[model samples]
Target chain A: MVVYGVALLAACYLIGVIAGDALGALIGVQANVGGVGIAMLLLLLVSNSTSIKLQLGEATASGITFWSAMYIPIVIAMAAKQNVVAAVSSGWMAVVAGTLAVLVSFALIPVLSRLGRGAPKV
Target chain B: MALDTLFDSLVELLARNGLITAFLFVGLVLALSNWLSKVVTRGQVHGSAVAIAAGLVLAYFGGVATGGSKGLADVGLFAGVGLLGGAMFRDFAIVATAYGADLGALRQAGWVGALSVVIGVVLSFVVGAAVAVAFGFTDPIAVTTIGAGAATYIVGPVTGTALGASSDVVALSVAAGLTKSILVMIGTPLVAKRIGLDNAHSALIYGGLMGTTSGVAAGLAATDPKLVPYGAMTATFYTGVGCLLGPSVLYFLVAAIL
Candidate 1:
């Protein structure tokens, strides 16, 4: 059952990758466009569908949940692969760009918060 | 002589199946990180944050030891780490996070949350690109890549790879994104009350604007456990938004400017 979930994810991933490439070609970008995002949308659609949900059963659903929580480890693997020292040594641009972006974004949080103040409560 | 042969065979076997070895090694790192988070930091910082820091350190040493570009994966025993941390699995893992989201809940966040996502991406891009210019990066590709990195780490590399930026530039974008993530993780709770990040509505907006799921999630967990899901929801969408916009519209915009 767990394997079924993995199979489903693999299917979504493949489709997402294909669609992303197609989109990139269509736009003349020469690269996959939002493959991860497309795959996520596909997964959300398949899992939330009532008919597919019935077929998935509890075991398969738990498998998906298990992998979803695997984000932490996957992220760790990603971090480990990055060359932080080289990036830092390349120039000051990386550090400056990152810090400035975050600081500006953080400062704007209050302004954005105010924009939503008048919305109706759900 | 017999014991030496046994050890060599064991090493060869692990080298042959690097993925399994990588999984085991990462598990150890995470186990240690979680412990450190609990004991040393007293849970003030999330375990994943600590784990990432450790990972970066290990990667630095791995490169120094092997003189290779792929970091620890360049070592024979951990070769599977290359595939495990490669684009395929990274995208797969990111997509899987959408499993827990409820579509209905997203709709409840309203137009404000959606607005925040767009504004967040644009604002971060502009700021990052400006800083890149100030630092003398004249190339549009480099500017766009770093700008996208400010949107999120995922967006940075995706844009870089798509645009054919050099490895060093891509690495810089990653560093930029990582810095943003760590900052958001540490700063969220400290400024949560001051920024009025108390309710699910505000959390949704915050997530959209911040655009780093891990940072927003961990920060909200420290602020209020119930708000993590709400913040993470929009933060997930923020990545999607950034990925779509980064290499296309954002790239073109930077090209026009510089």
Candidate 2:
């Protein structure tokens, strides 16, 4: 039963990758398009549409939920890893921009916070 | 199965491929960070915050060890990390998270929420471009690439590749975006109280201001999971806006200035 759930995810992922790549090709970029987003959307559509028609068992449903929740931490870690690598080899300017963005956001917080308080309903 | 059990199975598969190894590394990092957060920060800090820091440190070592473009890919066992963490999954995560967002909540954030996304993207671009100039990057492509990267990691590379900027410049932009994401993740919880980042409404504004979806989502998850969708909803648009502006209006402005 859970096998059916994972199969759904795997199919979505495959379609997502293809769709993303096609979009990238259309846009003239050489990378994968919104594969993850496409996959998630596909999953959402399939799960929602199939719920009424198909009797997805508890084990199957839980499998889908488990993978969905895991998406964030896993992706972020991978992205962070790539980012760290790019920053290290890209020379000082890249490092500077990265470092400076963090510093600037920190400094901007107080100013933005005050500006955001125009209508504090709470 | 429970999360602990999931991690148990995941860690054993680390050597299987890039995706599995990537998952293993992330799980290990989260576990370690959660432990640190509880023991050291007394739970003041979020586990994702610590995990990102640990991830970056390991990434650095991976790059050093393999001398490869992809940090973990340089190492044999971690090579699949390149695919696991690539744009496809990144965009999918964003899309999936955004789908969970409710459109009705947009009213709570109001016009201020809308304005923040625009202001945040432009402001970040300006800051990034200024840094590029200060560092003696006189070329428009380099400046624009870096500036776009400041907007969001996704926007940065997209703009760079579109404008024919060198790989190095594009890479820098991604780094710039990543740094912002990491900072947002770690800083949100600490500043949530002071900035009124508690409600669904305020979370939208916070997301608009931050703009990086992953950063805002992780940060909001740390601050309050209920607000993640709200913040991420607007944050998604921030990326779209950044993509629109990065290669066109912003690039022209930087070119003129340079």
Candidate 3:
């Protein structure tokens, strides 16, 4: 049944990739565009908005869940490994951005912690 | 002669083409990192962090050894890494993520929860873009891609791929996200007491503040297992919000600024 879901994903990607190309051309970016993201959104809308009764099996349900959870990590790890080699030479800009982002976010912890009500404001 | 050379021939084939070899290499790296985490840091540092660091070191050597465009790809045996790490698989993984999420919790998070996701995405993106500018990356694409990355690992690549940003920029985005994730995982427990991270409401806020889903989940697990569900609930929104704003509002904002 995971295949059932993948069938849906494939359709979304096909639409998404084409839309990405068209959007890229319009914007003049000439890239992969938001095909990946678009597909995700399309899938999200379909899954969330409608309650399709697939009556999936336990194994299939697990399979789909596994893919959903592990998707980003597996793909990013693979992509990052190949790209890290090139990124090193792209200069330290990427490194700098990453380090600075972490630092800034860390700094905001105290302020952000104050946002929600916590333990009677004590 | 045939019998003697059989093993040599097999090894040669494996080394010559990297498709399967790349999978092996990834697996081996993961195993090594898990081992390091267990024995060295005693799990204080996650295996994921260890693997990323090790991969970077290997990539540097691969670049030095080969002087090629792709680090490990320079080695004939590791060529499979290229195909394994390509966009096709990345997109596939991304598209599949939507299936598992339950959006019912968003309503439960109410207004504060929603606000947190939005603020988290914007703050992270702004910080990433600022650093990109400081580093002289004037191009909007690079800035937006990196900014998206700062939002979350998933958002970074999706944004990078969408904007036609270079692979290096995408890689940087991933690095930024990974660092944030590792920090969140380690820091959450230490700061739990001070921040009053003791309830579902606090966990939700924490998740929104730290948008990395895996990081939030792991950190909450360490701090308080009961908080995991709450934190994860909002962290999902962080990814959703990041993905939504990354290529649209954030990209345009970066473009206008630079």
Candidate 4:
């Protein structure tokens, strides 16, 4: 069963490559759309657990990472498609956004936690 | 007659360049995402980081080799695809187990998995948006960036889920680690040019959006909703600070290297 699943995943990867090539041509960017498809296939594989009742905590974390990652390009492409933004420029914007993210995360994470501690129970 | 002709030509251009081709790509990618999640995870362990890592790394290399440029969007897309594929593996196993007439445990695992992601995205989006406004940022890009970061802080489990599928977990984590660096290296500049947000305000707005999404993801993964609101707030605030400080720091680092 496991082998079959892996084989199925590989097949999907091949299809993804084909799709990515097509998408890449459409976007005219030096990027591969197929990789995204393949990666999604891999995510679905890891998140599943059988009767073993795999730890909920672990699985959820894994899911979040994959889902967010998946959306990045889609968002970029969507933004590009809408003409809200272009694909090439997104890189720099992401840097500014990322830097802001790190600093803000560091500063506010603790303060927020403390405030929550003092706040009335909901 | 010329004006009418020009208008018709423009409409055709828009239809050809923007709509049909782009959506076809989106559909292909989305369908691929769904299927990838299902196929790769047919029968794999749920919580093993190593297993997840193996799958992600393979995907990453595959992506890089195929595409030639491992830029911001590529990494983000890859990480998302990796995580989904990994998670789907776990989900399917449980469903398969239930197939043999065992439905008891499926409820908690499946529901929890779905709930965590759904709530994380929806709630984080709301909180991030509100905070972005509170911070006096009106740009949509900034808003989305903040929301995405905020989603990171909701729970550790969710964070793990995010990382589990990505080949470079640190790179994808909260958009602050290696992942953000790559993105900033590529995504930040591109977006800045496209939107004409070349000033400090652009920096702040962009930072806020990115930070919010990262924070929300972590908060949700940690399994603490109380942190969600706080995560959004901190993300917004710190993003502002980063906006103010990033340029100077970046310059100094660059200068020293040069």
Best by TM-score: 1
lDDT of 2 by residue, A13-51 (tens): 788768866776675555454455456556656656655
Interface RMSD of each: 3.8, 4.8, 6.7, 15.7
Q: Which stretches of candidate 1 lie over 4 Å from their true place?
A: A113-117, A120-122, B1-8, B136-258
Estimate, for each residue in A1-122, the C-alpha lDDT of model 1 and write its tens digit.
Answer: 88888889888888987887787667665446556556766887898898988899778877677766765676577667655455455467777777777678777777877777656766
lDDT of 4 by residue, A1-122 (tens): 33443443344444545565566557443334323323333334444554222533444444343433333223323222111112123343333433543344333323332332354443
**Candidate closest to the true structure, highest DockQ:** 1
Candidate 4 Cα errors over 4 Å, as ranges:
A1-115, B1-16, B42-178, B181-237, B245-258
TM-score of each: 0.76, 0.71, 0.58, 0.26
Docking class of 2: acceptable
- Per-residue alpha-carbon lDDT of model 1 for B1-258, expressed as tens digits? 999999999999999988999899889988999899999999986776677677767767777888776667777888887777776776676566667566665566668888888999999989888888888899999999989988888888889998999988887788788677656755777787788888777887888889876566546654665565566656756766787789999999999978
**Separate DockQ for every predicted complex:** 0.47, 0.28, 0.28, 0.04
Task: State the lDDT of candidate 4 residue by residue for B112-230, as single tens digits.
Answer: 22222233233433453345445564544344344344333222113333223232222222332233323332333234334333322222233233443332222221222222222
Question: What lDDT score goes with residue A88 in model 1?
Answer: 53
Would you list the rank order by TM-score, best first? 1, 2, 3, 4
Candidate order by decreasing DockQ? 1, 2, 3, 4
All models: lDDT? 0.76, 0.69, 0.65, 0.33
Off by over 4 Å in 2: A1-64, A88-92, A103-122, B1-14, B17-25, B80-84, B90-103, B110-114, B164-168, B221-223
